[model samples]
Target: MLLEGKIVLVTGVLTPSSIAFTCARLAQEQGATVVLTSFGRALSVTQRAARRLPTPPEVLELDVTDPEHLAALPEHLAERYGRVDGVVHAVGFAPAVCLGQEDGLFAAEWADVATAIQVSAFSLPALAKALKPLMRPRSAIVGLDFDASVAWPAYDWMGVAKAALESAARYLARDLGASDIRVNLVAAGPLKTVAARSIPGFSQIQEVWAERAPLGWDVEDPEPAARAVVALLSDWFPATTGEIVHVDGGVHAIGAAIRPPAPEPEPEPEPA
Candidate 1:
């Protein structure tokens, strides 16, 4: 019950397996009342997923790219919950072609890449700004992230977007800290969620993580990441902000382990 009585807004839940869905479930289990957001056709999907949570929450319309929707969030959230305690930004998307290939950065249209940056990166601050009024002092803002320290094989524009997200969180922490608001990102290992499955060659990243992480990993289990998110949402992280907490089973901290060399060949009888 660490989050008892908190009101949190969770976005980007497309299905039951979604990381956002797991967070919503955990939040509710800890006594927090959760609200969800989705847009367009995905709204229905999110709505369905909401019912599967421990306590079903109201699903609100939120098209992050739409100015009108962003403007309406505060009032909408106000009507749903008197005030918001935390916000979980799980939204991200990128066109297929934007993922650079071995040849080079893909020839995908720049417009698509720009869209990815805006939604995945720039949207974090925008969300904080929009929800500033609703958030209480000490309110927490958490966003989903992927480690962007190096170029991902096929992550393409989305990689750029995540880097921006990391930077954006730092700036938000600086500006919002004075307001007693906290901003942070959880850099999770890849899960087979709808969003991740959309990325090409995502399995390659998964395989590498499995081999590299000492604790081992389950690409199908998003609960570990969800729990980390809930901890940040709770009062436990009151003093922590502008940080990226890696929940990737420590994969981000080390390089792949070298394979053991084949057993030395038996010495020749002549040598004996």
Candidate 2:
């Protein structure tokens, strides 16, 4: 029971296959009272996902891109849980044009790119501010991250957004330090989820990761990543902040370049 009696808020849970769903499920198992967030039609989707958790948690309204929803989060959490010990900002999105479609990165419209940044990067601060009133010293803010240090085939602007997110986490850790609230990220490898499946060539990255990740990667397994998130949310990371714990099977640390097989020998020519 790592999170015993703790209250956690988790966002971006749309289905049982979601990484956020796994985090929420594990949080409850560890004795945390977890609540989820969703918006519009997807609220129903998150509700359905909640039912699958060990203990069904309350679903809150939080469309990260919507200012109204962001502004309402504190009051909502106050009414429901009165305090929040940890928060998981698991939300991310980008328009199809901003991804690996025919329109390349340069061709992507500003509107689409902005939307990607707003949801994927800017929302971290927004969430922190909204939930600030409920948190005390040592409260943790963990964000979902994908290694954005280098560009990938189809990730495009979403990759750029993650880069911004990485920067934002550092800045947030600095600013929130006085309040003693820690901010960190869990950079997970690509996994098969409703979100990952949307990327056009995600499977190619998955294949490379599987081959390069020293511990071996699983595109279908999110439990490892989920556990990492839960650990960050717990008391174990008291002195750790502004750090990214890569749970990508060690792929992020390595070159991740798949080598080609050596050419076949020409012994037959010698015999001839």
* Candidate 1, pairs of clashing residues: none
lDDT of 2 at 7: 96
lDDT of 2 by residue, 149-191 (tens): 9988899999999999999999999999899999999999999
User: What's model 2's lDDT at 27?
Assistant: 93
Looking at model 1, report the run of 10 residues with the lowest lDDT sum: 99-108
- Residue-wise lDDT of candidate 1 within 11-106, one digit each (tens)? 989999999999999999999989999999999989989988887889999989888999999998888678999999999987777764564465
Clashing pairs in 2: none
RMSD of each: 2.7, 2.6
Q: Please, what is the whole-model Cα lDDT of each candidate in the order they appear?
A: 0.89, 0.91
List candidate 2 segments past 4 Å from native: 256-272
**Deviation in Å, model 2, residue 78 alpha carbon:** 1.2
User: Model 1, 22: alpha-carbon shift in Å?
Assistant: 0.2
lDDT of 2: 0.91
